[model samples]
Target: MRADGSERIVRCNEMMLSLFQCSTEKDFLELTGGCLRGMVIAEDYRQISAQLGVWQREKSADAHYLDFELCTSAAHVRRVDMYLRRIEQDGEAFWSIRLMDANMRTLMHVPGAMDGLLSRGTFYQEALRQAMKDRDMHVFGSHCPVYFNITNFKLYNASCGYAAGDRVLSHTAAVLKEMLPGAILTHLAADSFLVLAPANRLTARVEQICRRINHFIAMPGVEVKAGLRFFEAGDTSPVTSSFDEAKMACDAAKKVVKRSWAIYRKSMSDRVVLHTYILTHFTEALQKGQIKVYLQPCMRVLTEKLSHVEALMRWDDPQHGLISPAAIIPVLEESGLIHELDAFMIRSVVKLLHYQKENGLPIVPVSVNLSSLDFFEMDPFAVAEEIMERYGISHEYLRFELTETAVVRDKGTLRQALQKFHRAGYHVWLDDFGSGYSSLNVLKDYPFDLLKLDMAFLKNFNQRSRDIILSVVHMAKKLGIHTLAEGVETEEQLRFLRSSGCEQIQGYYYGKPMTPEALYAACDKGTYSVESRAESHLYYHPLRGHILRQIRKVDASQTAQMMTFSAYGRSYRVTMKRIASAQALHIYQAKFEDITEELQYDDKVRQTDDVMRNL
Candidate 1:
């Protein structure tokens, strides 16, 4: 076979002619259309060519072997094992070919024939037979079903190539077999394995197996996770259901960092049922108005006024009472239905803004969270623009919040989306900024209008956390990116944030997420005050940095009364008092007085001098 898939019959034996039912070499060539590819069935030829292309590109191996269907002159397909070796002479490449009749049944019957494990169908069949025999001996419940998944195996294949991925899979199977000597195992699919192991010490054994696989592969960002379900005595559930439970647990394990395995529990089963209900009824829930938009007010740190409201989702499932976003969001994200939810939220927020404007109520930007799937699964920007146009809302009244994880998924698409949003005069904020390891890189590469600090920083308030949060705020300020610190529950936190020059905040410190009607009522009742656009700009003025620096330098404990500072050729008197100095950094309350006018009053200046002298 030439490199271009054309056949060159340098030598042919009589057996080859007999197999093809051809009388002479010329007849065989005519039947095959002068190419080895023509002798192969179209489907088999495509697959073989694809594999050969990969091998040729990587130059990883000299020989390739696969099972293929050869078409005879009579158009009968015969399964054969085909072997091809790359040969080069005088800078010309050729393929040395050999073929043998293959009996697939005999090949499959051999144990550990599919990458050192049983195929999916054969594994199930053998597992059933073993279950029947064990049931007869009253020992069926001694074993458990486990689902092992390679968390980022696709990345390994993409980065290291499929050949290396296959080697890892084979090594994983060998490790499983060696660790559980009497276990029944199968290669379920790409980088996934199904196993039936004895329940005794199963958790520890699975952990060892996962660790061993990781060690053997020795690749960064590649690890194994296992889910196990121990069978109870006389538990009559189908094998498929048991495996489903294991898979549910495996999914749970994948969410947590450093968690190698998880055991199936009743709670996981309940969650699975709830997930199914949510996915099935999601569309109906949206139409029936069960899925709602709730707003959490974000307060401007300098003005103590609502700068904006984050649009959060709540599912008021009648039967379930209230489905938490934590539960609902994950199910929708996994099902790729989050794009719909995001679109709904964008439309709802726009509609609410229109209502607020019509009612002569205060209108602030409503920030809606976006899932990573939105960009790939739908045109989120187009949807938002259409919704805003329909509601007669401007882009400034709505914001898009994407998490750090979402931004890291596809930088190119996200970059383009961000550019589109910015060009259209919409603000895109990086939400949960410090939740992942790639925060600095994201900030460097992407253009964001605001940074919403992850709530975890305040969840455990300490000296270290306070320092880190302040540093992030300072960095964002220097980068000309506004900052919002979430989970601000205490006045001490608010004071620290204010001193740190953080522009905005949102958390229970102001109020929890509420319905739009409730938010309107709260604003009407003076429970919350909305900041005007002019006030927002004033709070973010260039002089704010100078003021913050002065506030940070003031020793509130020692000053106690009033202090004065000069910045940008303006004299300002600021009253500094310690708010809280407990576990975290010292919180200060500063009241600035632009006393450049006071310099004209000699009597007032004399009184000020006396006060300053006493201090």
Candidate 2:
């Protein structure tokens, strides 16, 4: 349909030429179906002095205003003009003001693509880390993500051919753009690409955008590792100096994941109180002797004696103390300080190895865990080799554990890396076997000398369910794979392990994780010490005490004056009082224990004087 005289309607791209034929506003309005209010402007008109004014030729100060009239069809265009108001100001003469909308409410600004990118990126990575800790396999975020910075991706070689790699990148990028509206692609050179560029949103908010991107990219069936990096106020790094930082974060993310996309996060200059607390205490713990390595003994099923030791790292924070490796490793990984943590753990283990050798106790295999991020971000095999050689320990003396999922990714590189360690005389342990996506295939494909049976399998194993447990155990035995039963707790478990033909056992039932000195002494004892302080402490307190201590501090806050908090594993209620003498608040906290105890007491002490009858 054509417009009448007044209104100019753009129905489609191709109708412009026919649209110009209707010259008059009334004709334009008539041709189109739209209402028009009175508005007028005349453009490009010429005027001349061809007037029959013989009378005005005498002494006329008349000049013809011959100019093209500026015309616009917009009505009330004058109302858009700006005006400065003379109002009270402390140091300025003008007061800035914005008129309210028809609803008389302040307008809310919508964040653009940049803000979305930052926020989603943060959320995606944090959620990924959380998922890993929780062992929530196939933990899909609310949003799938776009993947980028496939560093050494062609290194996969089998599934994706070299020529198809570029198509994969472009196809992936295009698919992401189609999935996420208002997203852009920025090439940061090489295999790196920045997708989901947010508008107006701050760098801090980029996590939300990254998460949305991840949500979409993963929805289409294939799993791809996406690397993420986030930039803030002023990260002097060249990659983040401009749009390329996103690509660099993409590149950095590939260090943690070949298929996972990442949002770039520059080192934080500004810190939240919790972050500051973690960082400060972590640094202090590292500096002092507070952070230490303890060994969880792995026993040979045949002898029911020690086979190896898995070195577990623990930290006692100065502020909120006793940080779990589960808690600290993740923060370090997200912060890109995980490499430091890995190095610290390895170095600590190596130091213990040296001390053990010096005392001449005949060291057995010492297994250490490697983060998935380390395999992608830092070459753990290389680090492990160096640590082994530095400690003058044989390859047989070492066993490095990698998650089945982490090993499955870039299997070629991972295999080659593990093979190198194996060749160097170190054993490779496929930790958490029979728990992840591909247990048998992973064992078949990768070179693993030992299989660290996940605690979940042991927890599930029962004499009543002997058929299921025996089948799995027999399978491992037939394959000539050494299976270490983790978290073996009772004598019954030991008897069950022997009956099931399991050759390795680890847990409190055998001997708990011990420090270097305690381990040496216990090893020299000619008997096993199955009970550990951690278990006894855990019996009284399910979680660490230091965590509870920190919860108390939160209640001390003026804004958050009471501590009524619930965590995934624990809950607490607290109150705080400021101590003028100490210049700090004293926090009083009660865990669920107090409430349960009080309830138990209340039931018994029904009346105030009822205690006499009970006595």
Report lDDT (CA) for all predictions.
0.77, 0.49
TM-score of 1: 0.66
Position 369, candidate 2: lDDT: 82
* Model 1: pairs clashing at backbone N, Cα or C within 3 Å: none
Candidate 2 ranges beyond 4 A from true positions: 1-276, 279-284, 461-465, 529-615
**On residues 144-208, what C-alpha lDDT tens digit does candidate 2 reach at each position?**
22335443444533455655554555554555455545544443223444443332332333444
Q: Which 10-residue window in model 1 sums to the lowest lDDT? A: 104-113
Question: Could you give candidate 1's per-residue lDDT for residues 143-260 as a string of tens digits?
Answer: 7889999977889999999988877877787788888988888776566778988889889889989889889778877889899987788788776557767876887898787899
- The number of residue pairs in model 1 that clash at the backbone is 0
At residue 349, give the lDDT of candidate 1: 86
Task: Output the number of the TM-score-best candidate.
Answer: 1
Give all candidate RMSDs, comma-separated. Answer: 15.3, 30.4
Runs of candidate 1 with Cα error greater than 4 angstroms are 1-107, 110-141, 150-173, 186-192, 216-223, 231-240, 540-615
